[model samples]
Target: MSGKNVPFQDLFVTMTKVAKDAVPIGGLVLIPPKNEHQLLFVLGGTAKVQVDHKHSQPILAADTHFIIKPGQSLQITNQGSHLLDISIIACEVVQLSRADHKLSAASVKTFAYFQYETVSHTPRSLRAMVQKLQEPSTFIDMQKLLENQFLFQKLIYLLMDSHASQTDADPRHAVESTIEYLKLHYDEAITIEDLAGIAQLSRRWYTTLFKEITGENPSDYLIRLRIDKAKELLTMSKESLYAIARKVGFEDEHYFSRRFKQKVGVSPRFYLHNRRILGTTVTHPELMYLLGTIPIAAFSPDQEFPSYLLEAFKQVPKLNNSHHFDPEYFKPFKPDVILAAEWKDYENYDALSRIAPTFLLPSHNDWRDELTDVGEILDKKKQAHRFIRWYDDKRDEVREQLKLLTNNETVAYARMTQEGLIVFGNQSSRGKILYTELGLIPPEKSLLHIDGKILSVEQLAGLGADHIILQIGEQADSSREALLQQPGWRKLMTSPTSRIYTVGHREWYNFSFSPLSTGFAMQHMLQMFERGVVR
Candidate 1:
């Protein structure tokens, strides 16, 4: 009787029942083995179906249909966020002889069951049939029994057709089908060769086509998908890291951590701590450095850094030529939080916020206020306050020293660029350090704007300052040398009361209002004024 398929005409439906049940979140439904075969169709939500307490598959609404054989127990757990609605159809079948128009008692076997494969897309009529079967019938007449028999046979035929269509599908269609399967079963241990076989393609060709289509190899794509799910569970659930690792298809937690870091730029523990910070602007990195934590990555539009920070940030990866709010570029290095300055042109805030907790500091906020906000986000308010205090003390000390060395002498900061001479105003970071913090006065004709303003050499000379701190740009070295050959520059160089000091452009221009760069800029200024040279 085992594994025997009775002819359609010989099969008779003795009894049939339709049961509709709703399982709440975290609810469980167990159906013990009975003498009838059962068809389970998910009406809504998701359920983890376990057959015979061994085989398990996640069934989603309208996507899959399951059959439970007689003597096989079924277990369903609500795995989705909402209620799980499912319809179960149980029916008893026995062989009947049409010759005598009688049921064959000897052919009634308890272990006999239909060998139907699970179908992903059940027939549209199947649901309607199940609903009709649910209609009230106070008396079981011969006509009602014959109608049930006809419907049951139609369902068996639909299941058979679905299995045949899938098995006989074109190779290309099979590959597409396999890709859908991969998305649903990424947590399962799947191998490349197994996927290729499902796609009915050679492994090499399958991998090549997969990469060409998806921009990643099959294995890498699968791992990235798994990692994305792992990230969701890590942040949304209280599951342990080990449990998460196993749930996401990784057998070892250490291996999971290594892969996570490779993909996300931080270990799982660091991610859980919310320490994998990504700085979308130069200022955020400087502030994070002052907070005693290095960002996982920092945006460097020009691939440049201050001389003082070059060594400390030598190992940090630089994000070059990236849009201000490009979330796709930042997705691979899955940071715990993203720090960005509010930009007038920023339009993709939602995209970045989807990747991590994004903190957009006001663009008009002072560096101190920005640091306070960042500190709060990273849970390092104490460090932020301490650094602010230390900066204030240092500024006071530097101001007194400057006043003593050059009493009321006007000092100016300028940078030599390929375009022309650019001077900093009181609003700039370097300008704030010298004119605001250290009490040094800027030349009267210098640009007083928030950023560098280009000026002619004559306009710079017109300011008539006693001292000038000039930063030499990378492409302006020849310009600097050529400027030195000018008569006006030589006059200032040899002047008894006037002096000019040169520093690297990278060091000067990268300095922001953040404490780390601000403090470094202050030390550089003091070194120039005391030693008459930039060290």
Candidate 2:
């Protein structure tokens, strides 16, 4: 700012309110615009502000704030609620030059790219400053105002530091690096400890860190990456299942098929067969396009498949960063890459091969791995890596939490079983019981393309849940049978891992068995699992 009278020095700062009777100055013009920049700070309640034709989201609660350009359309609304208490601030500064050009008065532009689709680092500094101002104040002198503004600058510095550190020094960053390694070397036989060692962190710490970030552990996340890579080779390239398996870290094609079925929900044979390779392969550059294998987004195994494509798109180069992916608004595009996660979409994975290569991840696989596989197909290894690291991190976090819980003086387990099915007949918010809250998350929030149906058993498996109340409903009976008979179940049950303790013995499966009271039966079963009283 070469000008003598700097606009920043004369900034107006004040509290805004409407009159007692009328709309108590629900709005205010801080410094009646002589073409000055304005920044509105929300102190309390909700408000809607507009800049030119663009309206900001209704500012809710304290700490909400926004910046507007000179002559920008600005308005505030109480939204039929109590008049909001807000702080008004403004300045008319010569804009800073973005390029290497000197900061001449003619070349300067006000830094007003503060509006955000999300809480990003660029504007967070100013937002944090506003939030700090919203806190109860003591003295209000020019020095105090200057101090507050200085803190804003400091926040900007910290945001820059945090961003720089995340891409480089952050412990979670290793997961992403590992994904790139896996994508190129999916055929390599890698161990969890081996991957953790790549990051120079202890396995326990790596698992927790991985899970915290990526939502999947190292081994599981890596499997998805390998499977996806294998899909690309299996269909697009003329590789046998064994060759693909060997390339993607599986020692045997049979094991690969089992893992593929778990994660992709279809065996390799079914996937390749369902999706045809219509186009002939090109030799010079090896231009191969993978087709159809779409994961089904199910409302239920029985209901009609959702016509709605709860879609997302991305061109991410690595993890902890995304170029273009939105879970909110649905914009129609060819989806250069589309993820077909519905049973119907998967029927002809070959059809999509013509579009771009697509892979179907089955629900039987943990949702995180399924997500990672899609990422691998799109060459978004970093995102997958971040996810794997996050999951690994969280598992240890939960394990440590469980250890603390078990060590507590009076630990209790409220188990679930068929005979104890009556226990949860009428209850809300009781601790440590098997339950589902389908209504809590909308369709978009859910990982499964599912509606009301829930696979809490999978969730429990992931969380290392200690007990199951196996409700004695028709669904329960069917589930119990599957649990007892399934090979997957036998491996977990026979080998006593995951601290999974079933309260009742095999004898309680009788349809005629009845509990005197649902609550008491549940309580008794829970105690049995905890104390091994039933055994």
Candidate 3:
């Protein structure tokens, strides 16, 4: 019987079953039903009583009792051919306070002074209660059982006192407790002193014993644990390196990176390339986005991302160059593969490979072929070809869509900087989308040879294009607003059949080379042409 069927109020003995049975030779009663706490008393014959592995050899003698706690099993055997009379008490503590009336689960407190693994000798005072319990009774009154329950509570207190003393005296238990504490509080700022306090040992003594028990020094173990956790975060999320440093208990980002590189053998930026599975870390955000992969972190985001690339990379954290080349910073976001651009003098190449498989693609020129090379490395060759085809088709589609404008008006792409009005070439700053993709002709005087050629404001009017796409770069640093108020600017703005359309300066510059960026520029320019300039 269990506590479920036993009706209880205040403090009382919920369930009791008494029996006297005889077992023949070679008989076994292995692990019978037991309550939260049970008392097994040997009334007459000798029987082997075993609770667990450690409780063996402490035989049950006449007039002696053995206690069993929950989760522990009891095995009784009659080794000799003799009848064994045994008294078993199934006792459970129940809710006693009136305050517990509305509680969903009753509070059951245990008072025991011994570990379940060890055997305890019955005290002298408990003998009287054992004698009263041994009497043969098939039926018991509920009200009278409450009066006797007082003795059970008293028995629990005495056992608890004994257990506390034994547990405190054992040095092994203290070490185990300290290990458990470290596992739970590893993420918090913890010191050797705190661990020593948990173990109740002097700093030097605790350090020696911790190494003895765990085989590694306490500080080394803690660092390894933190790095392991950092590795997990690096693989799973797109959190910034700084945020990750703070999370794993490294307040100084640089020191965390140094420690990570020391243990992991690569700087955080390069280490990002390799993850557990097919995870990605790319230096080229624009190209990776076009290739259908969200990079865990990007190196050159150019201060901000374009509107089109924002949705894909909005959650992707930026990896700044300020921390130098420490690969340990990327340990938390354990990337499986790192995609990087070919460098002029790449120093972290070896370091990156140590962290994860790092692939360096061509940085400049022949970008279309470079896209395919990156695809082969990333195992997304099919998607790469499909994207190329889709981009070609979109270029043709936009070319046809802009037929009216292309036939009549030439487009001019220029940026207003602090130096002067800078014009762009077909190789950079959305020039390919305007001239090559959409088939928009450039004006004869539009500085087509120079990538970022600066010219006077008066010289801008010489460009024969019917429309001007002006990119305002670094608005805070530029005098474009004051220039626009000049008479020369007014004349340019009021030119017949010509319109001035403004766009983000740095954003347009960064979107020059990637397929995704080209697509965004194409669609935006087409919309502007079809709807006319708002201002």
lDDT of 3 by residue, 2-55 (tens): 442232334343434434455565576665545466667665566787755333
Better of 1 and 3 by TM-score: 1
Q: Which has the greatest lDDT?
A: 1
TM-score of 3: 0.45
Worst 10 residues of 1 by lDDT: 103-112
lDDT digits (tens) for residues 69-180 of candidate 1: 7777788999999898888888776654465432221122111124443546666756776667665554557687678767766666565556547654555544555566
Each model's C-alpha lDDT?
A: 0.71, 0.43, 0.63
Better of 2 and 3 by lDDT: 3
Residue 498 lDDT, candidate 1, scale 0-100: 60
What does the lDDT come to for candidate 3?
Answer: 0.63
Question: How well does candidate 1 score on lDDT at residue 121?
Answer: 64
TM-score per candidate, in order?
0.49, 0.25, 0.45
What total of clashing residue pairs does each candidate reach? 0, 59, 28
